[model samples]
Target: MAGEQTGVGIADPALEAAAAPLLDKLVADGVAGKLAAQDPTLWGSDAEAEASIRLSWTTLHKSSRPLIGEIEALRTQLRSEGIDRVVLAGMGGSSLAPEVIAATEGVALTVLDTTDPGQVADALAGDLQRTVVVVSSKSGTTVETDSHRRIFAAAFREAGIDPARRLVVVTDPGSPLAELGEAEGYRKVFLADPHVGGRYSALTAFGLVPAGLAGADVARLLDQAALVADAIAADSADNPALRLAAALGAAHADGAEKVVLADTGSGIAGLGDWAEQLIAESTGKQGTGLLPVVVENKDAPGFADAGSDATPVAIGPATGAAKIAVAGPLGAQFLLWETAVAVAGRLLGINPFDQPDVEAAKKAARSLLDNPDALRGTAEPSAVIGAVEVYASAGTTGEGTLADVLREFLATAPEGGYLAVQAYLDRLDDASASLLRSELAPRAGVQTTFGWGPRFLHSTGQYHKGGHPNGIFLQLTGAADDDLDVPDRPYSLGTLQLAQALGDGQVLAEHGRPVLRLHLTDRAAGLAELMRAVQELAR
Candidate 1:
């Protein structure tokens, strides 16, 4: 059961049986060339509805193979030009893959996925002459990536450097970003295949260009991905991706809504982040989705115990684990989850390719940018202690105290409900988030989720607003010691972050969600306040 025959080491008799019929239908429908005609049912929609079903397979094509050589050539050229650091300016699908590769391979690549002014400054801290910035977005119109390009391009010009020499673009063909890149004299423009969605673009230029620029063996990564694609084509129980998909579908059917991922090896450190965006944005809709909670350390006290509706999956170097490699395992995982989530979508009766709710917050943030006065009206603090401010966004009509408000909200959590703790701070680590979950889980009597500002707005925020009304939301944000203005925009990075936070709150409030807002003087104080609040509630 633990041998290579299991492929990625997923072995379960019940799940295999449950998946047999669906697997057979898929195979007979011409998946992996098992039959003549194609099967649109595999993606839970017709060909007209879900057009990007097999676009992921393009990465394995002979035609796409040549791009590996091109990426290698570009890598060599950048090295020759003495570029030491490569900063990836993007978000969600565009940034997650490169972040994982850079972390796994120990490359000098930094992903700026946040609007925190401190983060913007930190990403551009090094010498402009020695750095190359890769601006990536599948839509070519993501506000965060565009803001990054403008700010950094301004910084580059102010330093007496040619912004074009230090800039490259990765986006879909004919996207506005592509035209802008060409007009601005970009060093190179790698257009991704238009059919590939952002979450599925890891194998496209969106991911490879950054990974290659950061010195990863792009060829090897693709080689590993091809192997997984072959396994999926086999469409057998032994196929790792199929087996994993069956497991996920079966688990979901059995009422395991919380999918807890434990990523131990540094090889796939950022895999959870990538998978979070994919799983949340894809499967989360119509009042259902997989709530993926990535626990950095499973042995950390409270996480070892899961609620009744939780599924614990471990991905690391142990025997029967996903089996870590320098880069192969991560690539294998990128394909594995992509296939599994699609299959899971079929099981859940939802379209896995579309994200309808992700645009609401984007639209709201833009409206704030257009009319800054519309950002007026702060909710009176329900409670302010020390440098922390707390405002209940939902279910505030019957509150006695801030603690009582939290207690009342937690008390009303429906069976199989979850708590989402959103922290809008400069810190990116999940230690505090995870720690707060440790305290809140037993007290709230439900599973807990922790996400930083704006980033989660693009990912799980969809589920919180559109999916089941079972999420109890708590948002925490803080002031920064230093704030940098967005180049050519009326607001600073800090203000944009707050606007995005408030915009999301407005949307969630409009949807009748139970949300509580908290503002702290700074991140350190914010995290401490969150810890104290959880500890008090735990009592």
Candidate 2:
């Protein structure tokens, strides 16, 4: 039912009944009020210190008000200069929200969040004079972002255009990116609130800058969130956040750990993709957590049926259809999910503020980049299946085609474990790759997740390496038709991308998770062959 005050609807008698006691207990404990007050103690003493700073996300709707005018002014100035094309070069949290915001508003914003050489090349091929690159990095030193910034700068210079006038920087204050913005004379350097974590900074400059420049009414977005901000913090029977948290907690306790989300005419676009990260990264730690499975549509997965361990969730206004439904304006939706994930964190006994397992892959990537030669030692494909070179990372699988490797590796997947297809390919040029997840679902008979490269490393990567360790990994890499070289780095974009995939694969294999690395000799042909193999396997 839609909340008269918050405009968010959550209706499911089953979920409400199962979670009623938990919700009552939460209200009695004043979880919502404590969260609203930014009381770090709500998550217990162990998480207090971290939660203290992370709670700033709760205040962003108000604190971020000033950014609206500034962003609007930038957009006006860009438009005046005929610089209408906006290309966002960011990763993970810094990129996902803006992508959703722009898409929901039906605006055109080119998101360059991948290192796929073909993708980067395509982005570079855009009208340079009309392009304004928004480089966002919460850490300021993210390699993919740095590479993007460097390449774009070089491209600008080659076109006799001034990067200082075209590039916009969004980073934490006093960070390297901020410093670079100043030194390079970027058009604008928007500093984000330091207190807000990357994933939780959707309303911060990290999200606002890109979407605002891309012509989204970001101020209205803040207003929408503000409408529910107060209601979200109230500990009452009607509190959507608390109810959502309780529902997830209760479902997990009921042995339904996989939360499958489907969009049933929500009007809000890509909410699942954005929420996927928040849920996966926040609670996915300490070896016990909720795994959010984002389906392309309501009918894409079979989670709604009986006897399934998966909890079906609808992201729309309809009631009594799914076990739970979260409906609100895009802004309210973002905050609702964030708050629910935080509360769910406390329920699951983990610090949602920290991502301890995310660092392992980063360190592994850095190490691999230090010595490119050793990166190829384990990369020898076990078999050449047409356009794909398949490398069995889980141990020596009997030599066979790509389908055979998938069958063997998937069979090794624990009874409840899922299949994660990671594609480090150009999202735009190779958009067909996203369909692989849905296609593999019927064939594999397991929950499927498709992550587009390095971005997922920052989101679900924590869960894969830290959460339940029940993930079966399938990594897809493609040969860059044409590669772009980073100006100052010894490696090309292709090298960095390969290192990322190899590094994650190495780490997953080390952690005892089986990873089947498939290299696409010909991206288009390989994707077709791989999809064909999956369809054939289903027969």
Highest TM-score scorer: 2
Candidate 1 global TM-score: 0.90
Candidate 2, residue 98: lDDT: 97
Instruction: Please give me the total number of clashing residue pairs in predicted model 2.
Output: 0
Worst 10 residues of 1 by lDDT: 318-327
Per-residue lDDT of candidate 2, residues 293-405 (tens digit) = 88877667544441355788888855334778778788888888899999999888889888988988989888988887887565567789888997776565737766777
Evaluated with lDDT, which candidate comes out highest?
A: 2
Model 2 scores what on Cα lDDT? Answer: 0.85
Alpha carbon lDDT of each predicted model: 0.72, 0.85
What TM-score should be assigned to candidate 2?
Answer: 0.96
Give the C-alpha miss distance for residue 368 in model 1, angstroms: 2.0
Stretches of candidate 2 off by over 4 Å are: 1-12, 305-307, 319-321, 395-398
Model 1 per-residue lDDT tens digits across residues 1-539:
11122144444455456656765655554444331123444554343356444454334433357778888787788889887688999888888888887777777788888888787887778778888899998889988888899999999999998999889999988999999999989999998877678887777888888988888877766766666666666756556565566667666777877777665443556677788888888888888888877665555322466655766665653322221111237667777777777667776778777888888888888888777777656657776766667676654643454566567767767778888878776654433554676577778877777787787877787778766667877787777778888788788888788889888888887877777777876567666766775677854
